[model samples]
Target: MAGLSAMEKKLAEYKCNTNEAIQLKLVRFPEDLEDDSTTFNPEYSHQVFGDDEVAFGFKGLKILLYYNAGNLSTLFRIEYTSKVNENFDCVEADDVESKIRKIIPPGFCTSTDDFVSLLEKEVNFKPFGTLLHTYSVHNEEAGEDITYQIYQADMTCPGFRDYHERLQTFLMWFIETASFIDVDDERWNYFLVFEKYNKDGATLFATVGYMTVYNYYVYPDKTRPRVSQMLILPPFQGEGHGAQLFETVHRYYMSSPTVLDITAEDPSDNYVKLRDFVLVKLCQDLHCFLPEKLMQGFSQEMLTEAQQKLKINKQHTRRVYEILRLRATDMGDPEQSKGYRLDVKKRLIGPYKKKQRELAKMRRCLRPEELTNQLNQIDLNMQHEQLEESFQQLVSDYRRVLERLAQA
Candidate 1:
């Protein structure tokens, strides 16, 4: 983002996968409302920050996307309301895609391909800039597959059932290394678990965890890929599998032909040690320097404390979101719903007004809408620490814009 020109920034998008759009529709998550009349409108949902990989919709309705990991790329899963009598393969996937579009907002994407292309255009922000859509698989530079089998991906979508056990096996292996490497579907991002299949029938070996990237709204595509998680099975530990997997993933990026800018969080010494070992030492071995950025008011000590506080706040906010989502779901009971809506309004209003004052005091120049967004973010994360994080991201972005512009 800092390296991009002011002009190039406008055309930049953080949304990856221009190969083809895989759009699905459903109701909004107790999230901001969607055009309910639209089919396949999985645009709305009712999930909290760290909840199940849930997709809420009728049978067959979903939001879908295709992603490439190494040499493998596949159309991924989506959670939705369903009662499929037969196995997933027994169902026609395209028919399900069609049905979802009819039920959610936008009345079903006119064409999945067309809609995805446009969505990529709109969601053009990322925290860091990397050539996202250009992922390639190179066996020449890739690592030898590890000798472990995985169970499942731990998601509750229909089509993935057959592969569930292996996905779970993979996760079990992952938990052996890192306690938290499961998917966070609400964000449409995941920590990948790579695997290998045996010669005859069973699973063989697996790579522990994969790092995911998110669009932090600070980059051109309104997104950035951050190393959100890591993993390595206990049995596979000390044998250097972690280093092998790390090297494999890093090698893919090294071959990116362009510097792949990435970031990760490591409040614990073990992780910092791992990052230094894999990201820095190894990248330097590749003749590349791991660029460093020091954030104000954030350090190893603060990060661990922040992690605990985030869990608490996330649960609290999840309840609020859930209640609001229930109100949206049970519209049949408006009188009962009114109280919840009013409470949300009351909870949100005061903060925006307060944020308006805070921003007014801090910076002389701000657009009304931008200020409103900042205030609303502050309102959303009302707790002290949450609000501070919200502010750090927001103000840092504001400062970056000025800095980038000055450099230009």
Candidate 2:
């Protein structure tokens, strides 16, 4: 999590890049971020890119570069500068930062570390690293709950200098999280959630998704508590307990003034899907309407793209599930329910977007008839599976009828 200065240095010095091909050329600034340059008014933020060379345009300075490695899209928050001065100063013809500074959203962290640093600085509490492991065993004879071992960290313990087990650290995080429920100052971002099982008074769950917040000034001044790998145990997977933990964590972030900026890298398909379910679906459940100013601050186009992806995934997932249920009917075993759910999740969470989004925009939007046709196709597909099962049942009945006829 470096800063703009470090990114700029990398852009200036790097040679051949990895991933996708690179292209570069100067571009006209998008309307949302432009001011008087090229005298063009547009509805949206426009961007210009090249195969080996990528150009990020702004009001004063623009970044023009060739990548040394990786796909161009894989590059995120890559350090490049066109301008940096608050004043419209351009004494240095090629001073990188001064030119592109306008393109970056205000208070956006240049690197993950920079964002975490902000979290540390804003809060007075000790930083606990992560949750490790946990398990529970039913003690039928003892008539009491038996937790095997839980690892946690207590970074804030008085005179407790030993960094010791990861368990201790995680416990500190859990207890502190509970304590912050009473806190009302503007410091806590969201009650960062972590899992811990207290067995013989030790923690097992290790902190996983190391995260931080950038006070958003997000929709309605609520902070989004982004999370990562923290888990309870296999036994807790679908019990809905995760939601309770999440509620506590988010309640802190949603307090009056704390805003959250959850930045992810070029995310995996599963990561993208999870974020959609939480940020979009669940947010909708919460009536997550942001003020125009705050909402405008977000990447509307990106979210639009995300919503589309989620719809496709959900459709495909339903298809797979329909197939599985048909098979289960033929097999006549309820045992397959567990496996079917797991497979459905994998497909639903996997990344599958591949069309050139810019060009896809050119495709005429679906008409009412076309929309109806698509639904008909899905229904037809599902109907075929259902019919197969019906046919099997028919065959079984015919056999029984034949036997009765023979007896007659």
Q: Compare the candidates by TM-score and give the number of the best one.
A: 1
**Which regions of candidate 1 deviate over 4 angstroms?**
1-215, 251-260, 285-408
lDDT of 2 by residue, 1-408 (tens): 578688665444432221111112111112212232322111111221213322222232322221111111111143333333332343222323432333322333454344334332322223243323233444556666543222222335342223222112222212212111112224323222323333234333322222222332447655443343333322233433333343333433334344333333344443333333333322322221233322222234334432333222333233322332333332344555444434444443342222224224434676767656555544545654654565455334433433332342
Q: What's the true lDDT of residue 203 in model 1? A: 35
Per-residue lDDT over 237-350 for candidate 1, one digit per residue giving the tens place of the 0 to 100 score: 454445444444444434432222434544344444443344323322111111121111113432232223221122222222322233233435776445434443444456
For each of the candidates, the C-alpha root-mean-square deviation to the true structure, in angstroms, is 23.4, 21.8
TM-score of each: 0.27, 0.24
